[model samples]
Target: MAVTITEVVLRDGLQDEPVVVAVADRVAIAEALVAAGLREIEAGSFVNPRRVPQMAGAEELFRQLPNPRTVRYSALALNARGVEHAVAAGVKQVNLVTSASQGHSRANAGRGVEEALRDLEPVVAAHPSVTFTAGISTAFVCPFDGEIAPEALLAVARRFAELGITRIGLADTLGTAEPEQVVRSLGVVRHELPDVDFSLHLHNAHGRALDTVDAAVELGVTRFDSAAGGYGGCPFAPGAHGNIATEELVAHLHARGVPTGVDEDALADAVTTVRVALARGRSL
Candidate 1:
């Protein structure tokens, strides 16, 4: 089977940036990504401005997006309220994130892992038509807690499955995951959540991200998340730089004869936009 790529340049790219990208620019990037043959795009996040002012205009960004039929727009929601706002904004997918590490979960979500999962039930129930995917942060290891066991990640996935969430993503928040760990941890998760749709959210922290992506794809991971020009990371994730670039991932996949349906020239042009934005100390 072919791998499915989701463009996360707009959502994860702007998480820690200083400048706010105009609504028109966000829509422009989304339109460009759609034109590049990427059907799924994580457009923005529904979070508080006090924490992430860069994502302040998520609702407006959605409003300004070109309503394309072939593209599926998604947003990141931290809680039920955020999910409600995303659904109202006409997003088809809601990506909820939590960490297996108690310290990380508390620090990021203001609550423990269990509490975060419990809070997700209402959000999941409220949006029956919207697809809900739980992203487990620090799935391989944790910066604060350190050396997370495979069982820990499995336990969280089990809980998410119990909540009727079939789509799950394993995130390398700090970008320290090795290729061996990717295969081993994902092997166990695949066995446990056999029927669930799984994804890999890798960070290029150690520069082994491409190798890890290869291992994941070899292990039957079809869904993957990437950023344009390799933009974005957990502003809270210690020692993180950015996620794997969409162009880099596409190059690796396409060169290996994996069909991604992305035009190389168009993707290169998209990266130029990000390169220029970063040079200006901005994000898009």
Candidate 2:
């Protein structure tokens, strides 16, 4: 069976960069990844550009994105306003992220868990074409709260399910996760929410992302989120790398006899293209 890969270069990867990449470069990266057979890409975010200047022209980015219908293009949103921007910009999927921990949720989303869920109803109801994904940040552990329980994440997942959210993603925002932890955390939700299609958004801050993938795979999780050249770090979470590299994860799965349908040479080219673009002066 083939595992699905979602490239996060445009959203998560660009959020923490110091240099701004040109729109052409963004298009190039998206085109190359699609050409390499990636079916889903998180194209950009509708968040405030002042906070993440690297993603200044997200609406235009969606308009300029190549063959968006051929491959699913997604964006991250913090609230109803961001969801409105995503719908206006023509994104087919929008991800709403919060945390299981109240402290982290307040710091990142400016609301407690209950308030975040309350905002999600309008966001989901307003955009029927756009698939809504609730990403529970710091699903494993929190910088402020530390060692979040499995019950905490399960509660969030159940609420999203009740709210008619079609997709759910568990984010290791701070990278404080091991393989067993990954399996256990996701296993709990998978057992409880067997009908929910789930994905994992991982960071390589601890260099254990691949191992976490292994654990997730063992639990029958097939969808994963990654970035090119390992580029990206959470702007809100300090000291975290962007995400698992698409090339690296594809290569890992391929080596383990898992079919991912990604062209190895094409993935390498994406890494080179990103490095060269950054070297030549481009941000975004």
Candidate 3:
């Protein structure tokens, strides 16, 4: 089967960036990504506007995006209010970010993992019409608490599963996880959550993201999160940056005899669009 790549350039890629792309330009970027053959796109994050000014127009961006019914556009909703904002803006799907590491949970969300998941139970039950996916951040490694064990991931995944979230993404938030760590952590969670479909969200900071991808593919993973220009960083996780570049990921999959159905040429143009919007200079 072919892999499904969720283009996250609009949200995770720009959340930590200094240049705040305008809402109109963000819409153009989304159109370009769709043209590149991406079926699912993470358009923006519905968070505090002042906290993540780059994603300030998250709702408005969705309102301006073309082909709402045709494209599976999603947004990162950190809380119940964030989910409401995205739903009001016409989003049918959302990824709820939760950290498996207690330290990160406290730092990012000002709560423990258990507390965060407990609060989301009502949120998920209230929006039965909207599709929800759990983004388990710092699944393998946490910048604050050091290496995270597989049990941490399993605990968070178990909660999401209880909330009817069948799709969970295991993230290498610090990008410090080795290929073995990737397989080891995912192995434990997959065993207990047999019915759950898991995806990988890797960062390229240590250049092991591709290696982790290879290991996960061997475990039968078919979905991954990536951005066009290898752009992205964790606002809370220090020194956490770079998602595996989407074009490179597509090419790597193609070389491995896997079909991603992404047009590299069109994707290149999309990357250029992001560059111009962010006013690309000596940096990404």
Candidate 4:
């Protein structure tokens, strides 16, 4: 079996870091990930610099990075303005995110799930040329809203489908989901949204991300979102932790004979570069 691992180190990994990394270093990290054989990379989020200082120079960073033909670089967008920014920056792909849990939606996007979806309608309609992947945060548990029902997740997926978005990433936003919980919810969503290509965005807060991954693969999911060195968390989701480490996920997949097309040595180098850059930023 083969899986697509989307390297999120440049976007999700740095968003919550203590220090802001320079744009040049960010582009270097992105290039290194591509060199490591990653096919998809979430380059940055087109958000307010005041809200996420680490992702301030998203447009400039995109401008400086080399546009390779093989790798698909993507940016995160929360609203219409963000979609516009991504389009203006020449982003070919965008991940538009909303929360399944209402409380989380309010906190993260300042709107409820339905409202956020409504806001994204125009963004999606306007960007017909750009590939859009819809992500539902707190697909399992929410820090503010408790366990989310599978129906709620499916509802969000249906909305995305109606908007002509086929790919969806279900995120364990607070990293509190177990394998059984993941299997139950993902199973329901997959059954309901059979036409949607679903992916998992897991966090390693409880160290059960690998177990969830194993279960998801058995359930026929082949796409996953991960960060190098397990470095990521939602600044808006209380008690959230880093994403599942890209190296660890790749190792697990390879050991199970699931090809990821990523070079482990080069991935380690990219991780080291990210760590060094953050360390340097903190020391400054």
The lDDT leader among the candidates is: 4
TM-score of each model, in listed order:
0.95, 0.95, 0.97, 0.98
Per-residue accuracy of model 2 over 155-189 as CA lDDT, tens digit each:
98898898788689898887768878878888889
Which 10-residue window of candidate 4 scores lowest in summed lDDT? 275-284
Name the weakest run of 10 consecutive residues (lDDT summed) in model 1: 275-284
What value does the lDDT take at residue 41 in candidate 1?
88
**Residue-by-residue lDDT tens digits, candidate 3, 114-160:** 88877778988898999999899999889989998888789889989
Clashing pairs in 3: none
What pairs collide in candidate 4?
none
Q: What C-alpha lDDT do the candidate models reach, one value each?
A: 0.83, 0.83, 0.88, 0.91
RMSD in order of candidates: 1.8, 1.6, 2.0, 1.2
**Per-candidate clash tally:** 0, 8, 0, 0
- Scored by lDDT, model 1 comes in at 0.83
Question: What lDDT does model 4 reach?
Answer: 0.91
Deviation in angstroms for 131 in model 3?
Answer: 0.6
Residue 68 displacement (Å), model 2: 1.8
Candidate 2 Cα outliers beyond 4 Å, as residue runs: 281-284
